[model samples]
Target: MRVVSLVPSLTEAVALTRPEVLVGATDWCTHPAGLDVARVGGSKYPDLARVLALRPDLVLLNEEENRRADADALLAAGVPVRVTFPRTVPEALTELADLAGALGATAEPDWLVAARRAWAALPEPGALRRAVVPVWRRPWVVLGSRTFAGDVLRRLGVANLYAEDAERYPRPDLAELRARRPELVVLPDEPYRFTADDGPESFPGVPCALVSGRHLTWYGPSLAEAPALLAAQLAQPG
Candidate 1:
């Protein structure tokens, strides 16, 4: 079965299914090393004609990455598209199982059990303080409540100040953050890397920590590695 992955995690999923099943991937779909193939531009803004030309039997997408119109057009053209939104660890495992079933591969990884154990075993925090996490740098978007990233922070006993009013990632006015007065702010190295020292000056009076976006944001197998990293941060007294 020829498969095309437009989502980054699905690209990693395709890699887990073994290289032979993957026929095409978007430019951002690099994960499992050494499995280079075709690149289709940005996952959300893919060239529809070029994608159709690939003649893939199946294409993968994420609600966050792929636009609805594009998915609709592809479906209209009779190209099957599998959409996924992996929020919690269980959801992520489910998505992986669905992809494996789609690929007709039986071997699977049980990541949830390990994740729960690690989650439950989180070290007692030296201090529980509120923090704001910025995922993007330019407009200064943050990881608010009801999202995977927000939930993860909650698990760590860190309160999310914007949980009540903001969206998953909302660009609030500078006054809002100042009013909230978070104990320490966290900026991730992701779509835009915010170094610990570089942009903290923009939002003064709040001590900040530059964090690994993949660990804090990426909601799949990556979560297994997140706790260890977070533990180090929690160890530091506020």
Candidate 2:
């Protein structure tokens, strides 16, 4: 079956599992290095015409990454669209299994199996360290409650300072974040591209760790390596 994926992580998952099935993907889907699929557009603003032109049997979308308008348009055009919302590691695993099933593919890929095992083997966070994780820098948007990234960090013994906030992604003032007096600040390099030089200096007294956004945010094969990778980054002297 031909598939078009708007979510980068899901694009990678489908491409790596069965490349032939993916006929089109968003411009942001940059994994599997040499993917030769038709580029639709960005996750937020997908080119509906281009996507439909691919004549895909299924279009994949993420509830967080994709816009509702695009999904509605596709549905109106008689295009089948599958939207997934996985806010935790287990949820991600289940989503992958379900997606694979929909594509007539095996869910027991090596990476999928390893990811499940890795997350399952993790010990509970005994004493959590309070941390403020920034996903964007300019407006200062942070990972808030009920987010996949927050759940990931919580599993690694780091509690998000704004996890109890009302908004899932809150744009708090720098002064407010500092007032929280978090033990560490976790920075991811996507949606904002926070670097060691750019992000760390903002928090003078607080320690900071620059992490891969893919591992921290993406829910795909990356999960296999994320647990250990994030742990190592969080352990760094920052």
Candidate 3:
């Protein structure tokens, strides 16, 4: 079954599990390093004609990473499209299982098994640290209420300061974020790559943790390593 994947993480998940099924993927799908598939385009603005030209049996999309119009167009053109919206660790695991099943592939990949175990083995929740996690820098958009990243941090004993905000991803006033007085400021490298030299300086008094965006954001094989990787980064003194 030929597949076209718009979500980078999902592309990696499918490619790692069944490489032959993936005939096309977004340019952002950079995992499995020498992936020799047709590059459709970016996740948000894929080349519809290029994807249709691939004549894939299935097209994978993420609710957050892709646009609805693209999915609609694919469906209208009679290309089967599967859209996944995993908001938490369990949901992500379930999504992978469903995706694998759809592709006639086994969901019991070693990395997937390890990821489930890693998340399950997370230490019992302890004292929570209030943190403001910024995904972008210019105009400063942060992880807000009901987001996958927020849930990931919550599992690690960090409470997102904007978890109850009206918007899932909100661009909050820097002064407002500072006023919240977060115990920690977590920074990720994707969407808008935040770095030690760039992000830390914004929060002068708060402890900042530089984290791998793939671990914090991507919901694939990386899940197995994220728990320990994030814990170590969060443990470091900012």
**Among all candidates shown, the one with the greatest lDDT:** 2
Model 2 misses residue 20 by how many Å?
A: 1.1
Whole-model lDDT values for every prediction: 0.73, 0.91, 0.90
Per-residue CA lDDT of model 3 for 1-238, tens digit only, reads 9999999898889888888889999988888789999999999999999999999999999898889999999999999999998889899999887777788875477778899999999987799999999998679899999899999999999999999999999998899989999999999888788887888998998899989899999998889899999999888847
Superior candidate under TM-score, 1 versus 2? 2
Cα distance off (Å), candidate 1, residue 142 = 1.3
- 69-115: candidate 2 lDDT, tens digit per residue: 99999999999999999988889999998887888875467778899
> How would the candidate models be sorted by lDDT, starting from the highest?
2, 3, 1
- Find the number of clashing residue pairs for candidate 2: 0
Summarize candidate 1's per-residue lDDT along 86-185 as a digit string, tens digits: 6665566667776777788765654534555677677665556788776775566777657766767776777778777546778976667777788878
For candidate 3, the 10 contiguous residues with the lowest summed lDDT are 100-109
Over 4 Å off in model 3, which ranges?
Answer: none
Q: Kindly provide the TM-score of model 3 when superposed on the true structure, using C-alpha atoms.
A: 0.98
What is the C-alpha local distance difference test score of candidate 1? 0.73
For model 2, state the Cα shift of residue 94 in Å: 0.5
Cα deviation at 173, candidate 3, in Å, is 1.3
